[model samples]
Target: MHHAESLYEINDDLTPELMGRVDEVIQRYANRAGALIPVLTECQKIVGYVPVELQEYVAKGLNIPGSTVYGVVTFYSFFSMVPKGRYIIKVCMGTACYVKGIGEVLNRICSEFNMDVGETTEDRRFSLEAVRCLGACGLAPVVVINEDTHGDVSADKIMNILDQYT
Candidate 1:
């Protein structure tokens, strides 16, 4: 966070302070055996999401190939390149939920929020994602906002449920 000439060009979200933290993460794991995943994980934690710029920075710092970094990032479902919303709304797309009218619920959210799956709203208030299942078939048509689960979610009631989040 100290005021200093930044070596790398600053990114939109990757502020000089965050870049400094990323530098610390790289230096901590540099030259260590099997450090790529851990380094990327920590850096992603610091920066919220890992873009190509941070991947290249970590690769250069660790003396590894950028493709190797990109591969690991893309392979891992947990690593995200884009910034996530404050609330992550995961709609269940499993057979039970689908049959129970989860599609209507999903569509309502998309139409209301003007965003599709895997995309965040312009205000970054919420991110919509379609997941295979949430393991609550009894509560079909489920939508999970962050850690809290809402079962038996109807398209009509989805907006009200989302109001709690907003």
Candidate 2:
């Protein structure tokens, strides 16, 4: 068991240094009211995403219920329980984009990256999302990488466009 544990460390992201920072955040807000959000935000900034382990840690630190921490994390759109990629790829699934063959573009990305929608690549290079619409009907078959909007994207052209980012 010791050998196995040594080989595979759990919560590898939560190192002593990061946890110390987290402790500081908890201390700064432990005496204040409505401190959960700010604490979570600060900790997330320190440790990328707020995993369940950190949630329970914060809950214990604040003397709050674990469910309360979980609830707040789930309720807020800004708080993400999972890690995000460096580049976020939003593919429009609106009627206009669909008619313009956006599916092919989306499929191309999934096949090339070996990831479905709402999943991040293994290298953490990109996160794929299929939004209902991007409000750009004229720019059908749109793929937005981070904040850059790419319109009229095709399967053949997607790999080249994505290559520009890295």
Candidate 3:
């Protein structure tokens, strides 16, 4: 069991209503074997991200160790402890994209936004991520911002593309 002081401070967005939803999800899956993943998924859907405080809460609710929850979260790329921004910017880092100058595109974005891959902007506007591929090899050097994809992107054109989001 973790002491209160050792747990993460819950954010304001984690309202009673949200916690109630999480609790209901937990109750539904707590007794089932291999329930952790689904429970976490449902919680993430409600909370946007699964912070440590929520993890501990889920652990206790499911009668599982917090370390196990932490392990699963850390092992999964889809899981994130920090809240994601409104827009998620995914830059393809595949061989084709890299060969087509995605590195420069990524660098330009990082320099302009003052953020690295897997980091959200200070204003919580954009979150940048480097992905292995987007499966658009024909459209190499793809940058997907939110649901829109820009193929054959150039480094100099990144800022122009980002302007459309705001």
Candidate 4:
């Protein structure tokens, strides 16, 4: 299917440089079977998120349908369609964490940041997410900001912890 205007026209952020990078990635894996995933991965690394425009661009480059690209992007939990914040704060909501009052911690972080779960702050400084588990039951009520994991976090300590990121 042909679009009225190119994806670049619709999205101001889809610059020529980004399109060039996408083209390079597609060219590198054009003849390879199952190249969509790797192409999308490389594009996402450069652009942070796989926007609809990027997906369409990838589809066109790979000579595939846009729906196929969309399917792959949506099917993968790690793929994000929207831009992520500078800091991604993941609150563990596992049974152990819940029992230890993770709810309060989550609430405190959201209330302080003025953002709900899976939402990014207006400043794009932080994105809050309540995950099923962080695989650290021993450190019940854990909060991971980027690569730094803070175990045994208390609701009151959320601010101090976030301060380190800024």
lDDT: worst 10-residue window of model 3: 1-10
In model 2, how large is the Cα lDDT of residue 140?
92
TM-scores for every predicted model: 0.88, 0.85, 0.82, 0.88
Off by over 4 Å in 1: 1-10
lDDT digits (tens) for residues 1-166 of candidate 3:
5433334334665777788888899989979999999999999999888988889988998999999999999999899899988889999999999999999999999999999998999888899999998999899889999899899889888889999887
Taken over the whole model, the C-alpha lDDT of each candidate is 0.88, 0.87, 0.88, 0.87
As a whole number from 0 to 100, the lDDT of residue 82 in candidate 1 is 85
- For model 4, how does the per-residue alpha-carbon lDDT over 59-141 read when each residue is reduced to its tens digit? 98889999999999999988999988989999999999999999999999988988999999887899988888889999988
Which is the better candidate, 1 or 2, if ranked by lDDT?
1
For every candidate in turn, the CA RMSD to the true structure comes to 3.0, 4.0, 3.1, 2.5
Report the C-alpha displacement of residue 22, candidate 3, in angstroms.
1.2
Tell me which residue pairs clash in candidate 4: none
Worst 10 residues of 4 by lDDT: 1-10
Give the per-residue lDDT digits (tens) of candidate 1, residues 56-149. 7888888888999999999999999888888999999999999999999999999999999999998889989999888999999899999999
Which runs of model 4 end up more than 4 angstroms from their true locations?
1-9
Please report the TM-score between candidate 2 and the true structure.
0.85
The residue ranges of model 3 lying beyond 4 angstroms of the native Cα positions read 1-9
